[model samples]
Target: MVKRRDVRNRLLRLFVGVLLIAACSAQAAEMGGKSDARILIDISGSMKQNDPQNLRRPALRMLVGLLPEDARAGVWTFGQYVNMLIPLGQVDAAWKNKARAEAGNIASPGQFTNIEDVIKRSIADWEGSATLYQRHLILLTDGMVDISKNTKKNAASRQYILEQLLPKLQSHDAQVHTIALSERADHELMRTLSRETGGWYEQVNDAEHLQRVFLRIFEKVGRPDTVPLKDNKFLVDSSIQEVTLLVFRKESAEPTQVITPSGTQFDAKSAPQNVSWHRDIGYDLLTISHPETGEWRIQAAMDPDNRVIVVTDLKMRSSQLPSRFVLGEVLPVTVSFTNQGKQITRKDFLDVVNLKSCHTDSNGTGEARPIFDDGQDGDKAAGDGEFTLQVGQGLAAGKVELVILAQGKTFQREQRQLFELADPIPMQVTSTDEGETKVRVQPDAELVDLESLEIKAALVSQAGEEQPVMLLPSAEAGVLETSIATQELLGDWTLSISATGQTRSGTELDLTLDPVRVRGTATPPADPPEEVVEKTPEVQEPAVEPATMQAPLADEPATEEDNSTFQVALFGGINLLLIILVVLAIWIMRRRKQEPEFQLVEEDDQLVEEATAK
Candidate 1:
C-alpha cells in the first residue's frame, strides 16, 4: 500500500511539472521567441546640466506604455551605485502603472557615473546563452565611466567594460543599446558597446527628442510588424488583427486625423469606441482592434517619423545590422517574411516579390544596392524567403542608414538600420616620456595606404587656445609623433586630432577624432644653468712663523713622515750602542783572562805580606 501511494505521488508530480513547462513554453511562443528588455538610466550629477528639465520622465513613460504586454522588463538607475527602480517582471497593467509612477522619481541627484558596476548588476541574473527570449539592454548616459577622480581608474573601468563585461553580455546574447545624451559623453565607448552587441546606438544632443529616440529603440526591441505608409496612406491586410498608429504633432493639438478603412474618421479626442488613443508631449499612439482590411489614411503635417505598426499574422523579418563597424569589415544582411509565425519559404511567392536595398550616407545621399534570393549573393539557397546582400565595401567612414524595401505585388514592407563606420586606422594618443604626445595610426598594412595617412594635431590649453603641433613621422611606420611643449602643456589640456587618409582601394578617408584629455601639472622650467666664472689662480706665499709658535711643516704632510724618520734614526743609534757594549765586553773578557794571572800573583804576594803583618 505504501509503495503504491509513493508511485502515485511521483506520477502526479511529474504530470504537474510537464504542465508547468508547457505553460512556460506557450508564453514564450506567444511573444515570438524573444522580448525581454533591461533599461539602465544614468542618474549621475552631470545629467543636471545635460537634462535639467528632466524630460526623461516623460520619455521613459512613453517607452513603458509602448512595451508589449507579454514582454518582461525592468528599470535601473545608476550613478556611483545602482538601484533597481522597477523589478523585472512580465509587463502588465500593474507593472506599467508602477513604472509610470516611478518615472517621475528619475532625477540627477546621484554621484559618480559607475557604468561598469551598473551594467554588471543589471545582468547579474543572466548567466547562460539566449534561448527563450531575446534580451535587450538599453543604457542612457551623459558622461563617461567616472567612478573616481583618478583618470587611470576611470580608464580601467572603461576597459573592463569592453574586455570583461562585454563578453559576458555577448555570451548571454544581450544587445547593449547605448544612448549618449551629451557631446562630452564617451561616444567611442558607447558606439563600441552597441556595435559589438548588434544593438542600436543613438546620440541625442537635446532632451526634446528623447521621446522620439525611445520610440525608435522600442521598434527595434519590440520587432513590431509594420506596414509601409506612403504619403500618409497605408493598406492593412486581413491578417492584421490590430493596428497602432504613431503620429507626430506640430502644434500640440491632435497629432493626426486617423481615417479607418470603412471611412470612419477619428482623432485623439474623437476616437471611435474601440480605438485607444494616448496623447503625449510630441506624439500620439492610437491602438485599433480588429481593423478593417483596406486602405487607411492619416491627415497630419507630414513628418518623417510618422509610423503605423500592426499585430498581425503576417510579419516582415530581417536580421539587424550591427550598430557600428570598422572600415574594412564586410557583413552579410538578410531579410525575409513570416506568415502565422513561420517563415514563408514558398518559391512561387518569393518569385513574385522584389527586395531592394540602399544605404544613405551622412549627407542624405543614398546609393542603391542589389539584394536577391538567388543562391549567388551570400544566400544559402535559391528561391528561399531569405534575401542576402554583402555590404560595407568601399563605403565612406561615418554614419550610414541602411534601408531595405520589400514589395510583393500587393503589400510592401520596409526597415531601416543605423550604423557607424569607424575609421580603419583608429588613432591612439599616449603621453610618452619627456612630455612627448604621440598619435599612433597603425592600420592593417594590407588594408590602408600608410604613407597617405596624414595626421594633424594641436595642443589645446585650458583657456581654449590652440597651438598647432607638427606630427612628424615617428620611428615606427604608420606612427605620427608630436611633443607637448612644457609651456603649452598647461595642466588639463586636450589633444585634438584631424586626420585624412586613403584606403588601399583608393577611397579617401576623412576622420575627426574625439579630443583626448591629458592631465598633468605643467613642469617648472629648469633654472638657467649657473654661469661658470673663470678666475686667475691665487699665488700663495709661505708666512714667516713666530719663534715661539713655528708653523707645522706643510710639505707632503711630513708631520707623520718626520716622526717616522726620527724613530728610525733613534732605533739605529740604540742598535749601534748595543753593538759597541757587546764588543767592549768581549775584549775585556779576553784581557781579564790574560792579565788575571799576573794581578792574582801580585795580589797574592800583597795578601801574604798583609797576612804576615796581621
Candidate 2:
C-alpha cells in the first residue's frame, strides 16, 4: 500500500508541474505578442551633411528615443557595406543607447556611402528574426547616390537589390517605412518599397519637425487596448450646465473594445474626433474640451460602476479679450470659475495687488513708468468690458508687456505682452481767436501706457504766417489740453498744435500733421454806412429884362440883394412865359407832325405871309 501511494503522489506531482509550465508559457506569449516592431535606420554619407535644420545630433536622438519600450527594433547602417549593429530586440534605454552609440560610430570619420548593401542586409536580418506576422522594417536615408559607373554598374546593381529584397520582404509581410531626409531623395524607390511592403514613407526637411514624426509613429505602434464603460466612471456636474464627450480610434484596424458612459450609444463608423472605447488598449480620448470657464465633469469605464474616473471643470475664465494695447491704460479682465465637486468660490483673503504703472517705453529713450488705472479718474471699472490703459509719453515705442489683475472671487491674473503702442504723428493745432474761445488738442484715439502728449501750438493768419501762442498743459491724462485767450486774436487764424516724437524703433516722424481749429475775431472796416451827394434845383424868376438890358445894368450900381432879386424875378417871369410858349409850340408841332407833311406845310401861316410879301 505504501509503494502504491508513493507512485500516485509522484504522478500527481508530475501533472502539476506540466500545468504550471503551460500557464507560464501562455503568459509569456501574451506579454510578448504586442511589441514586435522593426526599426530600420539609414546611416548614409549624406547624414553627415547636416542638411535638415542644422540639427545633426538632436534629430537622431529623438528618432531613437521615441521607440516603444517593448518594441523590438533593428539598426542597419547602409553605406559601402551593410553594418547590422543590433538585431530585433526589445526597445529600452539600454538598447536605444547602444544603437545611438553605434550610429555615432558608423562610417568612422571618412568612409564611402553605399546604400544598396544596407537595404539587402536589413531585409535579410529582419526576415530571419521573427515569423512573417511579426516583422517590420523601416529605412532612413537621404537617398542620394554618387557612383562612377563604367558599365551601367550602379543602376543595374540598384535594380537587382530592389527587385530581389523588396519582394522577399513583402512575401514575409514585413512593413517597410522609409524616411528620406534629403530634399531630393529617390522618390521612386521609396514609393516602391512602401507599396510592396504596405508601409509609410516620409520626407522630412526640417530636423526639428522630426519629433512630431516620431510621435506619430509611436501612436501607430502603441495599439493600446480599449477601456469599456464598466472599466471607467462617469460623473455629471450637478452645478454647471451641459457637457458632451466624444471618443474615436485614430487608426481603427479591427473591431476593438469600446467603452462609454452608462446609457451612451456607440457608433462604429466614425473618425478621430468621434472615437470612444471602454477598454484601455484602444483609445480613451476626451473629445469634448472642458470649458474655459465653467463647472463640468464626466467619466467612462469598462465596468459601468467602477474602474476609472475623468473629471473636469471650468477653473478659470478671462473676461478680457485676448488683445493688447499701450501700458498705463486701464485693462479690464474678468474671469469666472467653479470646482465641479466643491461648488466653492476659490479666492483666499489677499492684500491689494497694486497694478504696475507705465510698464513700457515708447521712445526707446530708456524711459518707463508704473502703469495703473483705478477708474476713479474716468477709467474703466473692474467688471466693465471696455477698459483704457495709457501708454506713458516717456515709454519706448517698441513691444511692451503688462499683467492685468482681476480682483474677482478667483483673483485671476492675466498677462498681456508685446503690446504695440505706436508713436504719435507730428501735428499742429492753431486757433484763430486765441483770446475768447479756448482751443484744446486731444488725441483722436487714446493710446495704451501713454500719458499726456506734447501740444505745440502756433497761431497763423490768413496771410500764411505763424503767431506764437502759449500752451498750458492740463491735469487730464492722455489729453493734449490747453486754454488760449482768443479775444486778443484778430482775423481768421489757425492754431497749429503738433506732437512730435520718436517712434518705438527710434524712427523719426517728421511730417505728421493734424488739422487745427482756426478761431479769432475779425477787424471791422472804418467806412460810413451811407454817403449823400446833394443836387441844387435851378431857381427861375419872371423874365423882366433881356440880355442887352442886363449888360447895361451891369454898369449901373446894383445892391447884391436888389440885383439878385431882379435877376431872379426877371428870369423867373421870362422862364415862365417861355416855358408856356415852348410848351404850346411843342404841342402844335407834335399835332402837325402827326398829320401828313404836305398838309402841315400848306397850313403854315408863314408860307402865306412870305407869298404876300413877295
Candidate 3:
C-alpha cells in the first residue's frame, strides 16, 4: 500500500507541472497575438534623389506580406501632407496585393517632409481600430521635419512630435520604431521618439538594407519567441538611456546574473544603485537605470528553458493638444511624464521644462515666444506643466507645431504637437432699400482660389417662428442680395445668415454671420378720403331757351297737313340733339378716369421693366 501511494503522488506532481507550463505558453502566445502595426513611408521630394534604387517600394511589399495573416496593418505615405493609403484591417492576400500596388504607385513629388503630420494621422487611424494589446508604428524617413525659415515653425514641428504624437502612441500601448534612411535624417529626434515609446531606433546607410531591417522588425513583432530561454547575451547601444530585462522561467528559485559592458557583474541579492530586480512565479525582472552605452550580458540557470526580453526604460505621458485653430486664438498644451506605468511626481523630473511654438508656411516660418502664466491668458497655474501660446498674429496660415522639452538629472526628453491654422470667415451685412438685406461674403484673404460658397438667411420672430429669406446673388462679385418686406415682417425680427463653402477643394468652412436687427423707413401714410361738395340749381339758363322757341313756333302752323309735318320735324330734331349731348358727356367722363378702351393690363409697366432688366 505504501509503494502504491508513492507512485500516485509522483504522478500528481507531474500533472501539476504540465499544467503550469501550459499556462505560461498560453500567456506568451496571447501576447504575440495582440499586435497591430502601421507602416509609414516618407515620399518627400528628397526621397526621389536619396533612394535611387527605390528599395522602399519592395521593402513595403515584403513587410505587408510577412506580417501575420491575422494581424491588422495599415499603410501610409507622407510628404507635405499625410495620406493613408490603406486603413487598418486584416492582412489577407487580397488586401496585401492592393497595398503593394498602392505602394509602388507612391510618387515623391511632395516638397516638404511633414513627419509630425504623418505621425498624428497614423495615431488617429489606430486609436479606435487597432488591437487593444499591442499597437506599433514603423516610421521610415530620409529627412528631418521640413523646417521653415521661421524659428518658431521649426520648434513647433518638434514640439508636436514630442507632446501630441508621443503621448497618443503610449496611451494606445503602441510602440514607434523609427528608421533613419540617411545621415541627413534627424537621428537624435528619431532615437528619442523610439526610446520614449519603448521602441527601437535604427540607422541604415543605404536603401538596400531597408528590406532586411523591416523583415527583422516584423519577426520581432509577429513571431515573438515562445521557447523559454536557457542563457542569452545582448548588446545595449549608447543611444539607449535605460534597459529592462524580463526573464521568464518555470522556476523562480533559479539564480540570475547581469553583467554590464564594463565587465562589472551583479546578481539579484547584490544589485547596485542603478540596478533593481523583482521575482515572481515563473518570471524575474532586472532593470538597469541609466545603463551604460555598451553591450550587456545575462546568464541564468534553470531546469526548464527561460525567455528574456530587453526593453528600454524611458517612458512618457502627456495631454492631447488642440489640432484645429481659428485665425486669432490661443492654444494651450500640457504634458507629463511617467516611469513604468506610474506617474512621476519627483521634483527633479518635473523641473526645467521648456516650451516653444512654431508656425510653418510656404513663404517661411515664425516663432511665438512663450507666454508666461500670470493668472490670465487661459493658463491656470505656472510650473504646472500647462503651456499656452496666442496663435495667428505673426504666424502664417498653415501647419503649426508646438514643442516641449524637459530634462531631469537622469533623463532628458522632448515632445511635439501639431495643429492646422486657418483664417476666420469674413462677412459683411447691409440694409438695402425695400426691406431687403444684402450680405456680402468674401473668402478669407489668406486663402486663395476658393471653390464655392453657399449663403442662407432667416428671420427669427419674437414668437419663435423662422421665416426663410431667399438669398439672390447680384451681378457684382462676392455679393449676395436678399429682400424681406418689412411690411410682411412687422414685429421684432432677428436676421440670421449662415455660410458654408470650401476655401480650397478639401478645406471646408462653415460660419454664421452675426445677427442683426432688420430695420426700415417709417410706414407710409394711408391715402386721404375724397371731399363731398353741394351743387346749387341753375335758374337763368331755362328762360333763355324759352324765348327762342316761342318765336320759331309763331312762324310755322297754317294748313293742317303743313302743321303736322312741321311738328314732326321739330320733335325729331330735338331728340337727335339730346342723344348727341349724352354721348359727349360719357366720352369726357371715360377720358378723365384713364381706363383702357376695351383691354385689361395684367401687370404694372414699371414692375415689368425692372423684372426684365434683372
Error of 1 at 467 (Å): 37
Candidate 1 Cα outliers beyond 4 Å, as residue runs: 1-33, 146-164, 251-255, 367-370, 425-476, 479-614
Estimate the overall C-alpha local distance difference test score of candidate 1: 0.81
TM per candidate: 0.63, 0.32, 0.33
lDDT of 2: 0.48
> For candidate 1, which ten residues in a row score worst on lDDT?
545-554
Find the 10 residues in a row with the least total lDDT in model 2. Answer: 301-310
lDDT of 3 by residue, 54-142 (tens): 77876776667556455788888888888888777888767877887787777687778888888877777555423344678899999
Predicted structure with the largest TM-score when compared to the true one: 1
In model 1, the clashing pairs are 34-134
Residues 1-614 of candidate 1: C-alpha lDDT, one tens digit per residue? 99999999999999999999998877666544558899999999889999999989889988988887768999999998999999999998799889989999999988899999989988999979876788999999999999999999999999999999999999998898889999999999998898778887899999988988998898778866677788999988777888878887755564578888788887778888779887766777778989887899999877877877778777777887666655655678888889987899987788888888877775575667768888885689888688898877656678876778777867767777777776766677666557655567556565567778776778787888777877776788766666665444557878787667776657665655667777656776789998999988988856542322233344534448788688567656666766777799899999989897998999999999999998
Ranking by TM-score: 1, 3, 2
User: Please, what are the lDDT tens digits per residue for candidate 2 over residues 1-614?
Assistant: 99999999999999999999888876565454344565555555566663423343344444454454656777655555566666667777688778656655444232434556666665554444343235656666665543333437667666765878777776776666667777877777876776556566667876554544544444334322111222232333322232223222223434333233333433334323533222212233222223223222233222211212222342222232222233223333432334542333322421232233224334332433332333443355543322344433344444543333333333222233223433343223443432455555445342311233444667787888887777665576434555556555566776665554333323332322444665555566578878787988968845554432332345556559877788778657766777677788899999987789767777786789889999
Off by over 4 Å in 3: 1-32, 125-131, 147-149, 224-614
